[model samples]
Target: MKRHSIQTYRRIIQITVAITFIILPLLNQLGFTFIWGNFLNIHIGDLTLSDPLAVLQVTLKNQYFSPRLLMSAGIILIIAMCFGTIFCSWICPFGLLSELVHGLAKRVLPNTFKKLNFQISGFKIKIYILSLGLIFFFLFCTRPIINQLSMPLWYSQIFQYLFIQKHISFAVLFVAVILFAEFISRNRLWCRYICPQSFLLVIAKLLNPFHLKVGYRKEKCIGNKNNNPCQKACSLSLDPRTLNNLLETECNNCGDCIVACKKLGKALNFQFSRHFS
Candidate 1:
């Protein structure tokens, strides 16, 4: 398949999943009670799928575990282990919003200013935040304070409240502020720097060395040595050329870089193997 075709398919899936969250909540308001709850906790008939991290927090605090919660969390963790947090690329509503705003910023901003690099890496910051949150949870019996920073959960909750409860949440304001910052800064500040939710998934993916990932063919790259198109196309500012390590922890396998490389060198492709180099 053409590289753009692969990316277009991913975009369609991303848009569909984002819309599903919005429509499902409205369905409940219209008396169709087939599904309910936000991303933190979702129920469909007898089956449930929930945030594994949220489940972990509750289990730790109460010193109790429900079969249903464990099952739901297991399903999500299994998916992450196999596909390396594909949820961030293909299912997150907030990721869609961030990508849209970032794309527009890319077009308007000069090339030299488009990619911003903070001295502190976003991935390390998220790990630090996750460590502290878990420490607080154990010491203070905190009520999953990390959940409060979840933009996608907030995105889904906004719709659930608006449709199911006839109420508006202040969480919408948080999303708006984050999006505005992303637009001006031309960086996915929230997803890269502060989202503690994806931290667990990243660890799971790292443990699974054979997870699907974007691969790079260094021999075929014909682009200018100084300027890499694949790197430029990355929404999260990841260097796709570094296939040896593949930056598995932070990359969501979004395929934007693959599409960008296809036109110039056809060096990047998605593969389902542990051999990255």
Candidate 2:
């Protein structure tokens, strides 16, 4: 196998492990719980890695906030900055669905794929404000109102409102819009714009070791700059050649760029740090 294909295999394993950690409990197969089999859990070898979903629940519950939770949140945020949306790319169920939508969109609308920027600046501006509110609500309110009330979290109403399919809240409605938008756009808009989790991850990932990078051979990358299909093919639609270009943290490193480079036969390919191996 080629060097890059080997790296891809490693990444797949990493993601599978992470997703399994989150998925097992929902099946009642993990065999432990926080309170009398109510809150399902497991111990990782000896030390519990903490149920990722439970950890998320604790983060959203004002009652569960602690120095430990804060510390964990910090750690998660740091990781996100480096890998950006590793959770979405690798683990999230909804994210997997979004990826399917993206594949279908690419097939159905090849020219429109990644051509339109669904990223609204006003929406970007609100993420900071929303993040601040979550922090404040976690610290001061009766519930971590903003966090629990997050649009993505609302989907759990699928189980939360299991028996009685009642009316949806504003947050749920917002989540529905995001889901609908996934069908309408190339990449899922919710993952790109509104997810506070990705926001935290972006922070963590930025300071960590490395990012999905192209071995940029400028001599080769320059071709049809005015109508660069490589940039147009990017879900984030970012120009890869500009001097200060790594600003787009929404990249899931799905290898679309790799395929684009190959499509145009551009002299570019992914490079990973030795640590990732």
Q: Which candidate achieves the best TM-score against the true structure?
A: 1
TM-score against native, each model: 0.92, 0.62
For residues 89-108, what per-residue lDDT tens digits would candidate 1 score against the true structure? 88888989999999999889
Model 1: residues >4 Å from true position, as ranges?
1-4, 110-115, 244-246
How far off is residue 276 in model 1, in Å?
1.2
Model 2 over residues 1-277: C-alpha lDDT tens digits?
A: 6555433664575556445434434533334444111112223443333223335546667355776556535544555555555655555545655556666777787674554464354236446766676567667765434444333344433433432334444544565566667766665566666555455555455565565544556777655757576666555555555423243455556555556676565655665452322
Off by over 4 Å in 2: 1-26, 29-67, 109-123, 129-132, 135-140, 149-177, 185-187, 208-215, 226-229, 243-246, 263-266, 269-277
Least accurate 10 contiguous residues by lDDT in model 1: 240-249
CA lDDT scores, all candidates in order:
0.84, 0.51
- Top of the candidates by lDDT: 1
